[model samples]
Structure formats: C-alpha cells, structure tokens
Target: MSDHPMALIYGGTPHRFPMLLVDSVEELSEGLGRALKQVSANEVLLERFGDAPPTLPSCLLVDALGQVAILLLRERDGGAASVWYLGGIEAMTFHTAIPAGSVLRMEARVLKRWRTTARIEVKAWIGAVPVADGFMVLSQRGSGSNE
Candidate 1:
C-alpha cells in the first residue's frame, strides 16, 4: 500500500486469469512487499488432473512470489517500460502442502538489483505455519508494447 493505484498495478502486470496467481497486494514499499493468494478448489489447476487431491501446487507458490516481486519492482520504478520475466530460481524449499481454502501470505524482498535484473528472496506462509521460501531472479527487459 504505497499509495499507488490498484488499477495501475493490475494493468502493469502481464498475467491473466488462471495465470494471475496474486489475489491481492497487502503491502508495497521500496523493494519489499507482501501479497495474498487464496487457494480454492475451483482453481483451474486443481481441475486439470482428474481426481487429483485438492492441494495447491508448490510451483504456484513460486509463481505467486514472482508476481509480488514484480509488483514491488514496478512500484519502485513507477511502472517503468519493462517486462518482468522469471529468469531464475534458487534455494527453493517447501515445508508443507497448501490445502484448498487456505489463504497464503507471501513476503518478498529485493536482495540485489541491477540495470536489467533483480534478485529477490521470498517466503510463503499459511496462518502461522511456514510453507515455502526461495530466491528468484527477475529480468527486466524493454517492453515490446505499452504496458
């Protein structure tokens, strides 16, 4: 909540629908932020594999973290003309399964930043339990079109 408009934030993002993992941004400032993702049984991924347990995919946790990282970067740069891409992930660790109906809280911080790339550390939790943590690299490239 850095006083930036939600409409602008959403418009800056490239993801849509099932790919937009971030449900809401809770906190945003400088190079740090927190975001939320509510896991529900109706999610598209849950229905992709018939009879699959209603567990939130761990990969989605990473995706959510990446999305939040982009939000932070975008806010800091005032929606710069760039496209954020998931360039790398490292030291990813999962501690528990995110069951349906759980509200996941993710925290991310920019550990390092360069002209075209940012290294971030992210952690996820459900209530009081830690679920996942990792480091990710986001590459910022010139936008091909107005973002």
Candidate 2:
C-alpha cells in the first residue's frame, strides 16, 4: 500500500475523472486491490438522476470494482498497457442502497486468469458495512477472440 496519489494511479490507467470512479488505491498487489470513492451530492450521476434523494447508482459501484480489477491487472503485468473490457458479471447481490456523501471502499481479488481473460470477485463496503459483491469477467481488448 503505497498511498500513491490519484494522479500517479491515473498514469497507470486510461480513466479520467467524472469517469475515473476510484479516487485512490488503499491497497494493491499482484492479485488483489482495494480502492476508494467518495460519493458526493454534486456527482454527475446524481445530477443526471435528478430530483431524487441522492442515491449512489449500482452501476457505478460495479464500475468502481472494474477499476480495481484494472489496477490489479496492471500490477500483475508490471504496468503493461492493455485495454481491459468488462466481459460479464455473475452472482451479483446488492445488500443495501448506497447514499451519496458516503465513502465507498471496494476490494477485488483475481479469481482466475487465462490467456487474455481474467475472472475477479469484488465487494463494496461503506465504513465496515458491506453493500455489494459480485464476480466479473474481464478480457484484454483486441485479443483476437470474441466472447
């Protein structure tokens, strides 16, 4: 856990803010990763949803998990550049609705990896409270095979 700033992590990824869901990495290793996202009322998604009590969207949570998976893949590949795409999601369960102004912590672990595809399991928490978990399949883009 280097506590590397978001800028440094950004250098290792292709995401930019308003789209770069994870703010900072809390922990990162070859097969595991943990990151944070501070949900705010002024977030674009919340603004887009409009007029509702600011609830964090579940899709954003999944995207946060995907970002962690990308971080893990980058770490595993020693910062090799590859386009990673979300291939599929499985066994996803949402425990509770996440509200805006909450800090979301996400953790992901690589479950398996093949030639150009990796399977990861991820979970989200809000200050020690579990919110969601799921398994996702990610594939390196332009790998020459279609799902």
Candidate 3:
C-alpha cells in the first residue's frame, strides 16, 4: 500500500494499476476536485502506435476525468464502500491530441447529486491548452448490493 493520501482514497475504488489513470489528487472540496495524470511513453495504450509519436487516446482521456470524479465521490461519501459506475457521458469535446510527455490536469465538479446518482462536469488540459470537456453521470451501488 502506498502512503500517499490520494492512494489511500483510491483504495476505496475498484480501479488498479494500468487502469488507474489519475496519478495524484491536487485538491478536493465539496463538489469539486482536481487531479493529475502523467502521460508516459511506456503507457500500455501507446504500445499500439509503435513508432508514431505517442498520443493518449480520447477514450483514455475521458476515463482519466471519470477517475477524478470518482475521487470526489469517494471523498464526499467519506470512503464508504460502494460500487460506482459510469452511467453516461454528455457533450464531450476533444480539443487536441495529448502527447505522452505532457501532464494531464483534470478537474471535476459535481453539478448535481440525487439518491445514488450524480452528474459531474469534467475537464482536462495539457498546460493551458484544453484537451477535453464533458459531463458524466455516475451511479453508485451501495455496499448492501448482493452482487
């Protein structure tokens, strides 16, 4: 287990290495959070491109944002044991290709929350350049679920 505070918070989620996109949590508060992901040349997804300049796929970029949103949810719920799912995405836009050597800064804010579901607005950037923005719906299954 890692000693980093963010790693401890991440322990509440089901994500693991490789699939765990958020590298660090820089800030967190009610309904808001910010995180970072260091894009590296050795990223497993970049392997498919071989000799081409390494660029993170758009899907992964969205996944990164989702992970950040999850962090906010986990913090808000006080590390409750619950399973979260990405229920939907809305109006997402990709502004540019993210190169491997760059760091991705992700921000998520809870737009609304009701019962077991939440609508979060997420955005990603490489330096000052906007890379992606969208809204994601996340649904939580309480620990009481039989599954």
Model 2 misplacement above 4 A? 1-4, 47-52, 142-147
Best by TM-score: 3
lDDT of 1: 0.83
- Candidate 1 to truth, TM: 0.87
Q: Please write out the lDDT profile of model 2 over residues 59-143, one tens digit for every residue.
A: 8888888988888887787666567889999999999878888999999999999988999999999998999999999988642
Q: Where in model 1 is the C-alpha error above 4 Å?
A: 1-8, 47-53, 143-147
For candidate 3, write residues 95-146 as lDDT tens digits: 9999879999999999999888999999998999999998999999877631
- Each model's Cα RMSD: 3.4, 3.4, 2.6
Top candidate by lDDT: 3
lDDT over C-alpha atoms for residue 71 of model 1: 85
Q: Candidate 1: lDDT of 1?
A: 31
* Cα lDDT, all candidates: 0.83, 0.83, 0.85
Residues 1-147 of candidate 1 have per-residue lDDT tens digits of: 344545645755788786888888788888898988889877867524476568887777888889889888877777776778999999999999888889999998999998778999999999999999999999887665333
Q: How high is the lDDT of residue 30 in model 1?
A: 83
